[model samples]
Target: MTALDNSPNKIPSVTLDDVDSSVYSLYEKREKIFTRSIEGFFQNVRLFTGWPLLLGYFLTPWIMIDGRQAILFDLAARKFHIFWLTFWPQDFGFLAWALMIAAFTLFFITTLLGRVWCGYTCPQTVWTAIFMWAEQVAEGERHQRINLQKAPWSLEKVFKRFTKHGMWMGFAALTGLTFVSYFYGVRALVTDVWHFKLADTALFWSVFFTIATYANAGWLREQVCLHMCPYARFQSAMLDEDTLVVSYDPQRGELRGPRKRNADPDTLGLGACIDCFLCVQVCPTGIDIRDGLQYECINCAICIDACDSIMAKMNYAPGLISYTTENKLAGRGRTWKRPKLVGYGLAVILMITLFSYSLFTRMPLELDIMRNRGELYHEVADGLIRNTYLVKIINMDRKTHTYQLALSGLPAPRMVPDARIVAPAGEVVELSIDVLVDPDKLIEVNTEIEFRVETDDSLWYATSESRYLGPEPIRSQNND
Candidate 1:
């Protein structure tokens, strides 16, 4: 039995050292990744997804529908046009629901298949892939790129670097111009730039987006995903055991050692993996899948393609590194019926339904009635009570419209000015008019009035409610 040393002299004296936080930094410097090019099922899938995104982004602004850009987010005009529909600032509720739908949809997908959005559909990943391809075309393959990086300053190295950056700049400039076209009409903007007549704002934004695209896709690359993107930080909460993720099958790939092509792994006392680092070489983020699931892994499956190729060459079964579920790997049932996944799916569906309802019920005309707060009521001749109102008619349609205004609540009221308003497309028409009625017709000092606005074509109608203020009735005034 050991006795405790209670005496002060017997106890060992310890002193704490001042630890420099900078000495043990949590941050790791980013190493440039020269991802090896590979062609497989997943690469082909990227082609289908990535090419459409790039092409559609560049071409959609050029598409015209009903003499207007098919897809445009006119921030200056506060109008968003998509195909046949135009959303106004007043319809911002739809935007909120739309964002909710998008967020919940991403959550559902993340819960079902981890980080598939980042791998195949993310703008950063897609654009970065193009930039990487350009780099490879200019410098050469992954090994050649690495060699070029380490090579001393030479004409050939300078030429290769210049060519690579030139391609990136060209694409970035085109992307910027295309992005700006959604705000400024594509044809008009292109013509203006062609003639050196682009507006200062347009030129500024064009240059800004160009530099942004070039930097993000070419230079930042995985750093944007690892550090800047909030999705990577919160994706762990959305992921579940049943979620399909890019992973390495270490159980079937342990005891790693190099083996002859004809040698059996069983006799060599090794696993299926032949210690080839091709998977890590092909990873865009430069992460080793064998190290286990990491937040940095985009689930791009390039590593899977690289490993599959090596497996085929070595006469081994494929999917040594693949998109797989942890539950399946652990020999558990891999059903996707998780609670949070279902909840997210339901939320997405609910948001979609609400957005659809708002869209279908949307009207091209809107009405607003504002009573002059200065004087509640004005007395006129012939014992008449007059109330002034500022009427606003908003034309949200694609074409100009003549709207007719109607007021209700006071009996036999005469509108001093005409009730007709001519509103230009996506413009507001305001009317400062007076409504007069006999004092005997007034039931009370204050009355609720409804304003109805209808387009002359009868295609759209809208209504708003406001208060009508007047003095007490003649009978009540006499009684008082």
Candidate 2:
């Protein structure tokens, strides 16, 4: 046989005279994420805030103040009730303004501090944490869970899996029911669900939401933040380099490899990191923070806790991974009051001011007047030309009101039968009224008259300026 190196298109064995430090060994398999339990100042803070927030979500539907649900968005009635305020469709502008204010606040917060909402306040994170906690309780800690996954099927394993999934479904069902309860009062919802009297739409939606919650929180926990949520994609636009984000100190963590705890770095020539991989263990998204700041990182700081603990054990200063800015880490002074953040702050302030002013100036009563089209002007007794108009009054308040109507810039304008109309809350009262003017006073076919209405209880007032139809007269006399 011909020598291997002498064969046509055959390559000789290659040797690396100088090994490249940047090149890494490739593994065919992926490592599993076993997030170790961590406890520290920030971890405790997160637990304190996260637990209460979860409790509030599950219990809010049952909470009642003054014989009514504390918060109810009644879609059927087209009313939103929050504490003492009841808003109708006519007051939808308030809702729009409120949404604008919320969007601006989110923008301002995101610009100032990156992904704080996603980390702490997001429902997905909260629900996923709760589900994971339930799983941990049922299946033991991360190590035990990993062991269980590797072990053969056993009665104990089956029981644990069944119990964990059962509890997850229970919590998800509760979440779905509570969400629906806001639209249909909790009491009514409980009664209907208990009696199996749910409408097809309600039952379908409730089941769908329950299934969605369970699958998302229990199964797709990190995937939701990484891929599904639009906020994760758009949040980058709101963030600047000045925004505080969880970052790794590459300057101190580079040349990372397994090393002795107290080994001299001058001899080994390695950075601060001992390559324990504790940060990866604590990350919910299962990413190495030392790799870089990834979009998947929710800035939850669990990795910070884990790394800090590792640093403490190594007798090194904490903050190998920390909440810091690129500039600060790059040896530049950092300030929270950066110009971009300040601009966002000012815009938020302006939007809030405008929203609050609009809310304060909103009128509770509305008047709509339509002039009679069949007969613009009709002759009344004593040579009087009368015009007919229809008035529709809408009341947005929570109480019934009696409104007294009056007409200005007319000889005599009054309601067809009377001058007062009563309108119940969230109801429209449409009635006809007439304005009589003497024929001698008529100089044109349409005369403008201001119609005003004041509630008897002094709650609201409205006005509509409409034209009173009349006859043109004395054309020859006005020729001069």
Candidate 3:
């Protein structure tokens, strides 16, 4: 044993030449996939569902509500207007809650329906679908487009490519314009565009969003779902056996082979699957559904459409590939009682309820009282102890408010000048006021006080708690 066995088995080392250096490389050249189009039940559903969403996206910014943009996010003004409601910077916590609710809702939907969001309602999918349609219109069908790619460059190729890219760029520009309109009023944005005089920020974001849309929808396409999206990577953690997913029924499709349309699958020892590979061809990610669930699958159900159409043509029962749960496909009875799903569902409901309640009960005004730190109390004539306060009032309503201020918790406390405040709509007004209290009423060095503000026009009211600093009560002569 000490002689040190020098045999190949005993002292194995990989030579530099023997090591597959390609495996150690960081990057891989990407393969382009041209997705073939298909039509079936799910395809029709996707198409129909996309129309209303697209219409809403394009048309929402143009809608007016109460003489202002309906759904404008006025970042410069720090105001968000949504139809009848308006939010200020202080309402940002509501936005955070809304985002959390949305996230939990997405999780709940994922736990129940897999990646249906990604497949249908996701912005990437919708834009990609539109871009693909444009490509088909410009470059023809999938096979023709593939042939065109392989063919040597020619006038026809240049023309087609230019047209396709032109259409894509136009769509991207439109999408960018629409997105920016949410921040800038749509009418103003449209006027700016017409005059070619967009503001610096507007121009920059428009160009940025346009380039992003073009790159994501036209060039990246499936690669966005495959390599870039983190959702594709982590979706497995959100999934379980009972969760519905687009799947291939291996039990019915395992002995897959081509046969005549009318051939008896039993006698021929075949299955419902004719091994046509249409599912793969139509798959945006270029994956085979028969190979079992993969992260690359978007659950678009295009494969299901393709397979079902093929089955219909072959006079075989459909659903060779379909939306189903792993438990059902495995002959286990479907169960919707999973703890994680129920938890996510309950969380979504709770968050929605909380957000709605908070929104409904939100006040239209905010007030903050900041005491002057330089001096706690000032002794002036007439045996009055004065405390200076910086009162900040924010009007969240759409109309200007004249608030009448009142003080309590001390006897005969009076404001030095006026107790009235005027705050413009969506504006913060800070006023310096001196609160005077009679020395006879001072029982302690610090006394709790309340500042109440009420609007003259409506029942809107807000209160701020503050402390009034006063001189210590004079000790009686006998006690001293």
Please, what are the lDDT tens digits per residue for candidate 1 over residues 267-349? 88899988777787778887788999999999999889888999999999999998999998887887756998999988888
The prediction achieving the highest lDDT against the true structure is: 3
Local error of candidate 3 at 212, Å? Answer: 0.9
Give the C-alpha miss distance for residue 43 in model 2, angstroms. 2.2
- Please list the residue runs of candidate 1 whose C-alpha ends up more than 4 Å from where it truly belongs after superposition: 1-27, 399-402, 418-425, 455-460
RMSD of each: 9.0, 8.3, 8.2
Top TM-score hit: 1
Candidate 1 has its poorest 10 consecutive residues by lDDT at 1-10
Residues 1-480, candidate 2: write the lDDT tens digits.
234212211122233545474774573232334456678777777777788887887678787866778788888777788766678787888888788778878888988788888888888988988898898889998768877877899999999999999999999999888878878888888999999998777788789989999999998788789779998998888777778899999998878776767676557898778777667766788878888878988999988898888788777789989999878888988777677688878888998898788777777788889998998689987787878888989887767889998888765554566656888976789988777777765666777789888899766799999988777765535775
TM-score-better candidate, 1 vs 2: 1
Look at candidate 1 and tell me the lDDT of residue 4. Answer: 13
For candidate 1, report its TM-score: 0.91
Q: Where does candidate 1 clash, by residue pair?
A: none
- What are the runs in model 3 whose C-alpha is more than 4 Å off? 1-24, 374-376, 379-383, 470-479
User: What RMSD does model 1 have?
Assistant: 9.0
Which candidate, 2 or 3, would have the higher TM-score against the true structure? 3
Off by over 4 Å in 2: 1-34, 62-67, 150-154, 262-267, 371-390, 425-427, 434-441, 457-459, 465-467, 470-480
